[model samples]
Target: MKIRKLIRDNNYNEYLMDPIYSRLLENVNNLNERIFQKNKLVNLQAFMEGFTFYTSLNYRSTPIDVLPRIISSEFFFKISNYLSARSYVLNKFIREVYQESSTPIPDWIIKTTPYFRSEMIGFSPPKNIYIHVYGADIVRLRGIPFILEDNLRIPSGISYSYKAFEYLTRFLPELSEGYNVLKPNDLEYLYDILRYVSGSKDPTIVLLSDGNYNSAYFEHRFLSDKLGIILAEPNDILVKDKEVVVKTVDEGEVHVDVIYRRIEDLDYLTPGLVKAYLRGWVTIANAPGTGIADDKATFVWVPYLAERYGMKLESVVQPLTFCLYEKENLEKVIDQPTRYVIKKREGYGGIGLAIVKDDNLNILKEIFKEYENFIAQEVLDFDTVVSVVNDSFYETYADLRFFTYYDKVASAVLSRVGIVGSRVTNNSSGGMVKPLWIIQ
Candidate 1:
């Protein structure tokens, strides 16, 4: 039995080791050996260093276990199909939304979604591509998986995906003995999609970041370095006469073909900068104003959007029960607050989410009154699974985030699962990750 001992605080001799730990260790060693043989020392070292970081971080990720959930190829195929359908639906919806202001999006919903910038009308992307990379959080209830949210903006953790394959495969050999884990080659595929959208053979690509203050700065740097692209700060880019260009520290002016902007909104951009983007001087990965589509209000219409586009695929997620902020709906939601999860329209990373319990109804009602900008969703206490904690065991909530890339040719996806204390299993909120295997 290959098990590594993990001792918790105040317990040195009282350590716990599952037999599976040793198996994982063996697998990691084998993967390291393979990478070491095939790649340059620098590449192998960077990869291994990332693996080590993730491995060490997992232990500190609350009182949860790191067990491998084997997925069948059959299930993989199903998930892939669903993701493809979702991509199609989202792409079509974004186009439709931006193309027409007269398009009847619900009146009550739009009032709450501040991110929906109407300025994006008639502004098509350089290609019919938006959301080239997608990370959708999903959860399971009674063995049925459902989507929680769609991540279109600067979705991080692909670097971790590449590293984890090397780490987990070498660490737990037995787990892979009969399983076919999805390959990590998809990162390059995402890059290729972006390049195609830019329509250039050797497009001068730049990964734009909001300086180092952003949480996913390390991942951005890793991607740019690996892809052999330039990483630029907001100050490093220059838009002149409705054209995009890069101004390096030493080099004067270099033309830019594509801008993979990781920066959200910047206050310093002149009117000329935005005009350059609108003119398609450089291709943007997510394209501006895409944040509008991922709003909770917009998400509610996904199933309808799918149906409208003649897509027969049903949503993996059940319709989330929400109040429309109307007088009738508000009264209903407030009267039975305990059964819901209150969320503000423009919230992120679990900021404005409150689980309304019987004991907190009065407080919750007062909160709703003070912060009148809220939509209450029915509580989705999804089922849990067991993961090991040293020698003892504990159960933690988990969510699967599917990564998708879309080009004119096709839309494909890779998925990752996060497990930890957070009901919202975003990595920023203390979640350990595992790969999503394609069932074949």
Candidate 2:
């Protein structure tokens, strides 16, 4: 089937009777009971055991009864291959933009945040791969998957996708029986990239975390255990002799070759650590300063960048976006506030996102006066999918987070669904995650 036809005619009822779907319904029912158990202590314990840091304090059972979102094998391959190949071009483009301080690339777009303006200009990473790991938020609208934004710096939730797939296969084997579901090999790919950049056969790899207090600390721990590497906090690592090292109780100070950093803000990292990365003494999975490419304003120029770099991306869809730095675009956004989504250039997890409406014009006008670091994007009327919530199924807004390594799909896609009335599809924005599977 053609990609557009499949997307337009998407219907989960085709697999409603699948044994896997039945099993998921049963498990979710049980999960509901477990979550609402009469004993508070028991419920809390189950919540902690089941969710960990995957959810916030007000934990809710995620609906997994619906069929996994399906895409044709051909369509999947096309987009995946395109994104993978485009990564190289994007890396070079970003480097050139930063190097020359090009006029076409606005300073507000590249230097959206203080952390993004790095003084290390001549320095390059070990492999020249600025974005080692990327997660692109894609939304299907009018039978097309549109790239909402590119997460080039410190993207999370790959572990969630892997775990979801693991749980599905282990708990509902029948659902996966005949389907050629893609297995997540992100760890192997990540390890390969780390080793390639390290120039060491047995490089000491560490997953750096801000601390246990961070929300994603669970994922940090999970990836660390899964990758069989040390999980270190900022205090656990120190700069010595121009090299980043991790202190261990049993092994003393260990030389660290590669760091899969979970922390987002570069400023939070110690000067020594940043210096080591800048000096090329140590390698980071996503090289520092890559945040310049992830700026929301920079996303509006991806298509132009692709064309300039001699890469063709016919499969990728993107919404109409305009940087607020332009007066005409700013005026257009102000005039049609309800038709656009205003966002901070450096915001993540729905922190500074607002669906501007007539009523919010005054507030936005004040914000615009105070901040030029915003972008206006056409609000996407994304397609809806069946999602189970509170023991009932409802069509909810959904988005797919496609994880990429270099330029290839790394793992199973992570599907995030918003609550029934919610528009945002981020877990932090009252959204829940579902496992994504490609039907062969």
C-alpha RMSD by candidate, in order? 7.3, 5.5
Report the C-alpha lDDT of model 1 over 334-392, residue by residue, as the tens digit: 67777777766566756666666623555465555644466666777675543343433
TM-score of each: 0.78, 0.85
1-440, model 2: which lDDT tens digit per residue?
A: 22223323555332232333443344444454442222233223434555445344643533342335555566678778767866766687767865655635655555555446456576667867778888888877755778888888888877667666665565445445446766666677777777788889999998888876676666787778787889988888888887889998889999999988888764566556777787777888788788877888777887888887788877777789888787788788777688988888888988778876423565586557745788888887766765545434556678888878786676567888777766688867667676677655
* Index of the highest-lDDT prediction: 2
Model 1 stretches with alpha carbons more than 4 Å out: 1-65, 249-252, 267-271, 357-367, 370-372, 407-422
User: Which whole-number lDDT from 0 to 100 does residue 175 have in model 2?
Assistant: 46
Q: Rate the local accuracy (lDDT) of all candidates.
A: 0.59, 0.69
The C-alpha local distance difference test score for the whole of candidate 2 amounts to: 0.69
